[model samples]
Target: MNESYKIISSSILYWFSQKKWFVYSILIALFLLSLSTPVGLTLPAYHSLIILVLVFILVTFEPIPFPAIALLTLVLQVVLGVAPPNEVASSFMNDAVLFVMGSLMFAIAIVHQGLDIRLARMIIYFFGKSKRLFLMGLMTISAILSSFLGEHTVIAIMLPIGLSVIKNIDTQKTDGKNAVLLTLFSVAYGTIIGSIGTPSGGARNVIMINYLQEFSNVNIDYWKWMKHAYPILIIQLLVAYFVLQFTFPSSLKNIQIKGFKKKVQASDTKKNINHLFSCLIIVFIIFSWFTFNDKYGLGIIALAGALSFMIFGMISWEEINKNTNWGVILLFAATISLGFQINETGASSWLVLKFNDLLEALPSNSFNISWSIMAIISGLTANFFTSSATVSLIGPMAIELQPTDITFALSSAIASGFSFLTVISSPTAMILYSTGLVSTKLFFRVGILMFSISIIILYLMSQFYWINI
Candidate 1:
C-alpha cells in the first residue's frame, strides 16, 4: 500500500512538471469542487466561477499560455452544460477583452517606432546623473507607461535597454543586473498600480465595474475609478520606490545612471512592411480605444485592430497569424464564460453564505479586527486570484457584513492591491513575467518582500484615506 501511494505521488509530480498537465489538472479539480459545493442554484452556474478562477490563476501565472487554458475551461463549460455554446463564444467578445488587446497592440507599435526608447532617454536626461536618481527614472518612467499603456509593453520595450545600460556600466558584478531586476519589477508594480488609476488599465477593474452594476447598486465610472483609486495608487508608487531601493543593493538603488545612446543593430534587427502595417493597425485601434471604443464594443475594436494590423504592413497575414498567441485569447474568453457560470449557478452566493456562516463562528464586534482581517484576506487572496475577481467576490460581501466604520471598507479595498504573491494576479505583472527576461524564482523573492511591505503601506494609507493615520 505504501509503495502504491509513493508511485501515485511520483506520477502526480511528474505530471505537474509538464505545465499543460499541471494547469489542466488544477482546472479539473476546481471544477469538481465548485460543482459539488452547495453554493449555487445549478452546478453549471455557481461552479463556473470556481472553475474560471482556477483558469485565471493558471493562465496569468503563464505556466501555460492563456489561449490554451482559456479554451479548455470555456469549452468544458459549454460541453458540461455550465454555459451555452453561443454564450461561451460571446464571452470572448467582451469590451474589456478588446480594450486589453487594443492596448497591447498600441504598445507594440510604440516599441516598433523606437518611441519608448526615446521616451526612456528623455526620462534619464531630466532626472540627472546619479545612481539613485537613475533608479528613480527607471521606476517612475516604467510605472507611468505601465499605468497608461501597459506593464508588459513597457517591460518589453525597456528590458533590452535596461540590459544594455548595465552592460555598458560593467554591471555584471556591480549590481547592474540587480538594478535591471528592480527596474523590471518596478515597471510591473507601477503598471499594476497605475492600471487601477484608469478604467482601461486592467480587465479586473472593468469587470469589477460591470459586476457591481450587474449584481448590486454600485456603479463606478471610469473617472470616478481614477479619483478613488489614484490616491491609493500614488501611495503604492512611493512604497514601491523605497522598498525597491532598500531591498536591492544600495549601490544600484534609485540611481540616475547614464542613459542609452546606442542605435538598434541593423543586422540583429529586421523591419518589414508587414511589421509596419501590423503596428499601424495597432495605432488605429488605440485611436479607437478613446473614440469608437464604446460604439463598436471592446472585443470588436480589438479584433478590428488585430485583423487590420495583420493585413496592414508589419508582417504577412500568415506571419502575424503564426506569431500571435491565439491560445491566450481563447483562455481569456473561456475563463469569462466560466466565471459567469459560477455566478449564475449560484455557487458564489453559496460560498458567501458559508463565509458569512464562518464569520458567525467567530466573534466580530470590533471594526479593527474585521478591517485587519479583511486586509489580510484581500491581499492574500489576490496573490493567487485575479484582483478584480477578488474585489468582486469580497468587496460586496465585505460591505454586506456591515463594518461599524468606513475604515474597514477602505482597508479591504486598498488591500486588494497587494497582488505581489504571483505574477498572475495582475496583468501588468504577467506581461513583465512573460518577457522571459526575469525568472520565476526572482519574481517569487520580490513578490514576498512586496507582499510584506504592502501591509505596512496599506495600513499607513488607511490613516490618510480614512483619517486613521
Candidate 2:
C-alpha cells in the first residue's frame, strides 16, 4: 500500500512536469467552481478570472497576441454574459491601449531605419572599443533605447547585431557559448530594466500606473515616474553587470575585432538620419510633456510622432501593416478589460487578504522588510501572469497595505518589472526565446541570477532612496 501510494504520487508529478496543461486546467476548474458557487465573487470578477486563465493558456499552449485575445475575450464576455453586454463594447479602447500601439509602431519605424545601430556604434567609438566594453556599451544603448522605444523594440534592434558579433567571434573557432549567452541576455535585460523608467518603456509600467491612479488618486505623471524609478533602474543595471561578469567564462577574453567596422558603418548611415530626427521629436515630446501636461496627454504626442513619421515616408504603409504587433495589442486589451472588472469587483482585494495574512505573520513592525518581501513575491507571481496583469491585480492591494507608505506601493510596482529569468515571464522573454540564440537552461540560469541580484539592489536602494521603515 505504501509503495503503491508513492508510485502513484510520483507518476502524477511526472505527468504534471511534462504536461503543464493538466495542472493549469485543474486550477482553472477550481477557480471557476469558486466563482460559480455561492462563494460571493462578483460577475465581473468571475469573467476576469476566466479570461486570465485563458490568457495563460494562450501564452503557453495556444499562443496568440494580447490584442487579438482581448478582442475575442471581450466579444465572448458580452455574448456569454461574463461581462455586461453594453459595457463590453468600449472596454478595449482606451488612452493606454492607443499609447502602447503608437509607441510600438513608432518604435518599429525608428528601429527599422537602423537608428539603434547608429547610436550603438557611436557608444563603442567614444566608450573605448574592446569586446566586453562593446558588450556593455551595447547594453547601455539598449537600456536607453528601451526607455522610450519599448523593450520589445530594443530587442528587435539589437538582436541582429548581437547575432552578427557572436557569429564573428565563433568564426575563428573560439568557444562562443558565453559570448552568445551574454550578448542575448545583455540586450534582453537592458530593455527589461530600462522599461521600468517611464510610462512608455513597457506597457506594464503604464498598466501599473493607470491602476494606481484609478484606485488611489495619487497620480504618477511622466517625469514623476522617472524621478524615483530611474534610480532603481540604475541600481538594477549595476547588479546585472556584476552578475554577468561572474557568469561569463573565465577563459573568454575580450577579442577586439575591427572586422565589424563595415557592419558598424553601414548601420550608422542607415540609422543616423532617422535617429537624429527621432531624437529631436523625442525631445519635443518631452518638452511638450512638461509644458503641456494638462493640454495634451503623452499618448497624443506619441501618436503625433508616429503619424508624422508615416507622412514623411520614414515608414512606409506596408511596413506598418507588417511590423505591428496586433496580437500583443489584443491580448493587452482583453487583460485590461478583464482586470478592470476584477479590480472593480474586489476580487483582487480578497486575493490580497490572503497575501496580507502571510505578511502579518512576519512581525509587529517589520514594514520595510515586509514590503521588500512583497516586491519579490509580486515579481515571481508575474511569471505565471504577465507583469502588467500581475501588477494591476496586486498593486492596489500592495498600496492599501501600508497606506502611509507610498514607497512600498511604488517600489513593489518597479520590482515586478524584473521578470528576466524565464522565457515565460514577459512578452520580451517570449520574443528573445523565439530567436534561438541560447538554450532554455542557459537563459534560465542567466535570468535567475540577474533577477536575484536585481532584487538585492532594489532592496538596498529602497533603504537609502525611499522613505522610512
lDDT at position 358, candidate 2? 78
Error of 1 at 345 (Å): 1.9
Instruction: Kindly list the per-residue Cα lDDT of model 2 for residues 1-469, writing each as its tens digit.
Output: 6999999999988876766763575477467757553255666566566665666575545433445556667775676466686666566666666677777777777766766556556766865456777777777777877876677777887777666665655623334566666777777778888888877787777776666666666677777777777887877777787777778653445334355555677644545577777777767765765566445656666677678788877888789879887776766666667666666667667666656777678667476667767888878877656676666556666766655556767777777788776777776687778977656677787788777777777777777866432
Q: How many collisions per candidate?
A: 36, 10
Where does candidate 2 stray beyond 4 Å? 1-47, 63-68, 76-83, 171-175, 250-256, 266-275, 289-294, 361-370, 399-405
lDDT values, one for every candidate: 0.59, 0.69
Q: How does candidate 2 fare on TM-score? A: 0.83
Off by over 4 Å in 1: 1-41, 45-68, 169-185, 252-259, 262-323, 365-378, 385-419, 423-442, 455-469
lDDT of 1 by residue, 313-416 (tens): 54345544454445544544455445555556666566556666666778764545555677888788777776655654555445444423434444555566
When summed lDDT is taken over every stretch of 10 residues in candidate 1, the lowest stretch is 264-273
C-alpha lDDT of residue 295 in model 2: 58
For model 2, give the 10-residue run with minimal summed lDDT.
Answer: 250-259
Tell me how far the alpha carbon of residue 116 in candidate 2 is from the true structure, in angstroms, after superposition. 3.5
